[model samples]
Target chain A: MNHKEETIRVVNLETGYNSKKGATVITRGINASLYSGELTCLLGPNGAGKSTLLKTLTAFLSPIKGEIFIEQKPLREYSDAELSKVIGVVLTEKLSLNNMSVEELVGMGRSPYTGFWGRMNENDRMIVDESITLVGIENLKGRMIQTLSDGERQKVMIAKALAQETPIIFLDEPTAFLDYPSKVEIMQLLQRLAREKGKTVFLSTHDLELALQIADKVWLLDKPHGVTIGTPEDLALNDDMSRYFYREGVEFDRESGLFKISHKLDQAVRLIGEGARYNMVKKALARQGIDVVDADDCDVEIETTDNCYIMNGKEVPSIEMLLDMLNLYCK
Target chain B: MNRKTTMLLMLLLCLSIMAFLILNLLLGTVKIPVKDVIDILLGNDVDNRIWTNIVMKSRLPQSLTAAMAGAGLAVSGLLMQTVFRNPLAGPSVLGISSGASLGVACVVLLSGSIGGVALSKLGVIGEVTITLSAIIGSLIIMGLIAFVAQKVKGNVTLLIMGVMIGYIANAIIGVLKFFSAEEDIRAYVIWGLGSFSRVSGGQTTVFIVLMLILLPIAFFLIKTLNLLLLGDSYARNLGLSIKRARLLVIGCSGVLVAVVTAYCGPIVFLGLAVPHICRGLFHTSNHATILPASLLGGASLALLCNLIARLPGFEGALPVNSVTALVGAPVVMWVLFNKRKNEI
Candidate 1:
């Protein structure tokens, strides 16, 4: 899946904080390579050292052992100024600039390239305009950053990074506090950016299903596992995806390649239907801790059609009515 | 608006400075005519020696002192607020003024306790001692803050530390005052009251020249200040050296406050409120615009306050500190209310 050239490579890396006693290594011996023109998602549970890894990768924190190479140069070698031109970052902190216009905010990305006075030249202004247009925020160019919604602010940040024109972009939980559609939209935008712009887009996220759907490459990070890198389908096919995320009540459904909550099967119903309607009835029944099966031993039979569910020879207008009929008849 | 309009506004503000400066000279306790004031300024021999002496010796220098002190304090306040990212941050917020006062207290109270020589009687030597002591005190506090800023990560923490240091200095000043004579205490209290006409002749020249030099140097920080407004992480990511930048800004601001407080007796409000007024007027935090705008606005406001303080009815110029507070408090309140209304 990684057909493009590798932009960043991590080898035998150890990342964590340094205490007075000794090094507190969160995760060790991590080997990973991020290629250009790919969207990589670093998926992990809480306290899985995702942020530590991100911080280490961005050179914010020093790695205890091993080395990281950015564009074949040692990450430690590039000066902050040189590295900035190569790798842009978007952090999770809320920006406090209240009176700054979106255009000015994005124009700040030209800092490393601008002169001592930081006055933007024509080329810089054109790049800023292009980045804003790329993020589809041209209408918001004149608006203040404080007036924007969280989603729009995130987009503006992305535009800022885009204006930086770096080969790689690293974001720390960019979709964390956004609404559902906003999360999906941001993920999709990042995915498209990586694919179209040939950037090595790396982000750490808690959104499992969104990442699975959008990421070109997924890095499953766990404390014990260290790092597992591959495409989403490959990780799913090799059964590497299920081992780490496994919990008591959650099961990875291999058929659809998604995680589903494993419900109790104390109550049973034989679901008889096909297509979308049957799936809806099965899902509704599962919510009530009722199991759906094809066996005749079940007491209640739910036969679903295009818009209605028939249970026990009585036609129910909706899933709600079907649940009510099941409660009355099955008991 | 565009850069041209921004420049025009700055020019308009400069014009306001000139207008206020002239008004401050003309409208004082003696009520010198505009013609006499202009003639005196043009180096012409005025008919009345008393009017000439009053206009040249006192009014002109006092007006210049007030304008420079206001501009310096306001610029320093802008730097502190931007660096600390706290709206309420000012030169005094970091206790730099207390540092200066502490220095003055040490000299005044110690002299009174040891030799019975009042602060007003120390002559030229006493004035020089006060200036040197004030500079030393503020520099020591600023140096401590710069050292702590290196060790600490948060600006808020540094701010609190500065406040604590100020409290410590104030506590020492209180103890010194308790042991001193009544005349010494009265002198200290009057100094605390603040005045713009305190400096004249050689001292006034030194104060104005130092501020002129420092103000231009502060302009060199325009780029750094703009970067700083992006906050620490982003500023660092943009190749700014956060520790070094913080130290430079804090050092510049500390020196500005030190110089102004030494000359003007801890004048308030101009430093704390002028930046906010500029921000509200321009509706942008870009230091390129805000810096010059603050400088001009502060000068104009200070000149206006000086004029009001020296109105024909008031005896010995109604205390400047009270006038600044009475006038500046409303502007601050209005800006805060408008900012809240805009939800900025």
Candidate 2:
């Protein structure tokens, strides 16, 4: 797995839809390769064709131009049945399921391997149970799908994909409706699946920082710039993140490898701190248009301690008070 | 529920079907004793020749027709609900029943205009023609709807299309009725009222044979229906061809409804409600269980309704359509109320 195996290679792909009127291309001239044992993420602004790209790659939609290859074969060559044996997908569509247990829903993932009756054998049942365990949703096995929370449902769908035993998995906005913590959990789970299972996992998500932090490789699908593919650090170091998301008040913070809202702090203040709390105070001051500087002759000075902030000769217990004290003393 | 419990429920349903079939045979105008009815059914010659003729010709065929038609309608209903993914979908809801009525209406009017005689006078040949015409009529409508279904998405939209088409079919039927002679109109009205008693003698054999062939084929679709319950995209990703599955399910459901309507006159509510009742009873939507449950549950319920229709003191048997709606509506409402917008 560490030898860098390419599972999906797209050459000059153009993705969109066609109707009676004609074909409308969404994104074009995209060349990329997704590797096994790597969690690849596709990130873009809305309508940047992330879903379209996933659809085309998954063979749900025919590409307008260019070719996609799964392993060494062309995508068009694989029949729907063959593709099902190789790839599993979790879509963004809302499930309207009723009266089906979580275990049964996961069991349906073995459809490609089941006979006409779809009655699972012992091995299929074991695989289904293993998938539930793998997704860490053993507790939800007996629960009805209708009763599951959004996060639990998402996990069960992932378990279903796992039960399919496909090498490649594609998910569309898997973290879209989840809370912040659940979003992180789903992302980390996908990363772990890629690492431990050596499966090629590709997903499109709007969780930017989470993807930047956890993805093995990232595809930035900006509107003007086609697609920028690299590791997260490479994109941040090359200033691709900044250029792709070019806008006032938003700048990529290279030190954290995350984006931040940059403030043009014309006024400067001397700050004393050296750790986590210090950076928090610095970011807070920057948001208020005040810059932390090294100059000694400052109208106001805020120094961080274990439990208090010594700001403008007054002891403030919290950052909120420090802001208020600065308002009183400096403004 | 587990398999043993579901099997127990199925066994109970089968027992109920047998009990109701006996009840239907024993309780009638003649009021034959249970012993006598059993003796007659065991192929023994009874002392009362008149009793033998009545049981063999009337009650036996009616009971069998009621049970088979009920099973057919229920299976078709389950299929309609699955393919449309709506709680309210059925042959009746989807206008296929109206198409059957339209087919019969056209046949009745044509026979009336050409022969200058009522449809009742045409006898066995007439019944066969009506059955064939009704099947053709409903199947044609079902084919149209299936074609439209390919173009349309959304449950409510397809339902709305179904309801609209039903209204159009009813309108055409209304025009046909206007041209029909008085006796033809009366015969048409009686057929529309729906009856288990209408199918008797050799006509009963044809209806039963048709259902026997059609209903078993529906079981093969349990896998397809289960996959469809996951919705279109998920089912497709699992290697199902949605268009083919939809067409097959609708066609199967359509033929079942067509035959039942041709034989029983658009038996209402059994097709739509039996699946819901089965889902409620089994507490699962897996079609492997629900289809069989629907089959047996449908037979029991229809027999119960048939028994109720011909109960003591009434002048004649009640229209099965009226009894089915009366009994089925509440069962549906109760299930819906308990389940609260949950679908089959």
Candidate 3:
């Protein structure tokens, strides 16, 4: 394993857009360090400036205040050509391309390295093949980019970024349009690239559950709080994630590392048993305005065992019947 | 899609351009013998001096003008399509061709009505006035478009702006036609019909020289053009300065359209359809192949159109515009209809 190093260091960064009208700052006083050999995910509500920060760090939008350092040098000092060699990005902008083969599109990633005409030598070709192999989309090299599914397209874009051979990769919602399994696949692929290649991989995503599970570091951006950066485990344990999503009816469950809706316990009943069936039965009861309690109380105690529900010595064959009986008995 | 196949297709396109060029030079109203035409082209003695004169003075310049204008307009179309990332965008999509027509309308229509000058009286001098005015009009629009391209961040916004400008120019021309003398309106209408032979011998050399210089310059942009296929954000992250590339591409396309429309009188359908044809035949949108294919395909199609325009039945010569839309529109419609799912 390669040792982690701070490839990108930010101090008191204020990011936004500058129009002829005036400079409108989006986020203020954001101090963060993005390290190589780790996967960092930025989580925030919509319009919280996650994209603005990413754009500023990648030099798409100039920062309104503070400074950014790439490889211990000032960000402003690096030319656009120099910065392209250092960072690769997969953006959320929908590509409207047609009749272009996958390899040709991926070969375009070599622009920063190739000469003016962008003719790739053998070494560049080998790197492109390796990138496709890494992303496991070798089957798609000959197919047109427009024909590929959304997940396949996302993988192709990632492979394109990988082919650039940069030390840092920034993705804006890389998993936005992917299915659940594909989302997990993309997240794992990014994490593996960061760990194996020692590349600093950073991305902003709305997939909070997936990021909490797979990311090595998480940066939480919200309106009032500028940015809260820590490991996912540390953030969840320190109640940072919970505090970030603090609302009237939503509670961030530290145990599951997920946010759950806090339902009112209007009527409580004793429910017993554990395992998959028990959880399903509990869910069915909870949906019907009945709260499951650990302590024995009131009447109507239901026990689940051997894929069957028993209430007051009456064996219930199915959850539907159990719900029916509970409705009648509770009434 | 492979290199070998692309090379073979490119060679085929070049061969077609040659074959069509020869047919255009060989077949005409005069029906000069193929051997004699070849002899005359080779600078050998020919029995008939008139045949030699017709081939050298008329057909040669006309065919060369059509070929170069076709290639130039096709390349400019490819640039516009890539910059906007819109498949429907063509050389005149920026309203540059309309600007040229407006200039010709002002010079031709206004000349007879206001200055008491008829095209019959002015003759060749009137042609020069019209061409120069077309140049002035289109360059003014090109300059305006290039200026706006730098300030606007959105490609679609620039596209819409160009389209609105074109509409405004056409509206002005409509008003000019309403007030013009009948003879002046007829002259303006003839200019609007478009012809390859309108550019005289000296101007033919100039047009070819200009396109010969400008077309090769587009090759230097193949890399940037390819990156642009990935859309603006990806192109920018690839180290392509999007604004600069936009300005350069819009400038290249605008100048090419301006020159072609000024000389050729807004030749239509060749610029819009040739790139689409190349894409269909090559089955790839990579500019490295599509750009050259469009060039050669355009020249071949234009030569074919010229030959058909001057065929036996047509009196004098059919307008090159009608010939192009007649022969070229179906192939483009078929390519577009088949690829309706992915228009670009």
**Residue ranges of candidate 1 with Cα displaced over 4 Å:** A1-3, B335-344
Residue-level lDDT of model 3, residues B1-344, one tens digit each, is 77899899989988988998898889887778899999999999999999999999899999999999999889998899888988779877789999899888888888878888886458667777887899899988888888888888898999999999999999999999999898888888888898999888677888889889988988989998998888888888888988888888888888888888888888888888898889888999888788889989888888889989988668588999999889767866776678755556
lDDT of each: 0.89, 0.89, 0.89
Q: TM-score of model 3 relative to the true fold?
A: 0.95
Q: What is the DockQ score of candidate 2, to 2 decimals? A: 0.59
**What number of backbone clashes does candidate 1 have, counting pairs of residues 3 or more apart or in separate chains?**
0
- Tens digit of per-residue lDDT, candidate 3, span A1-331: 5799999999899998998899998899988899999999999999999999999999988999999999898888988788888999999977888888889888988899999888999999999999999999999999998899889999999999999999999999999988999999999999999999999999999999999999999999998988999999999999999999888878898888888777666887888899998898878877777888988666988899986889888999999999899889877
Q: Each candidate's chain B TM-score?
A: 0.96, 0.96, 0.96
Once fitted onto the true fold, the runs of candidate 3 whose alpha carbons sit more than 4 angstroms away are A294-298, B110-120, B123-125, B178-180, B339-343
**C-alpha RMSD (angstroms) for model 2:** 1.8
Model 1: per-residue lDDT, tens digit, B39-114? 9999999898999989889989999999999999999999999999988789988888999999999888889889
Angstrom error at residue B69, model 3: 1.1
Instruction: Put down candidate 1 lDDT per residue, A104-171, tens digits, no spaces.
Output: 99999999899988899999999999999989999999998789999999999999899999999999
Fnat for each model: 0.52, 0.49, 0.72
Lowest-scoring 10 consecutive residues by lDDT in candidate 2 chain B? B335-344
Writing each residue's lDDT as its tens digit, candidate 2 over B162-222 gives: 8899999999998887877888888888888999888768889988998889999998888
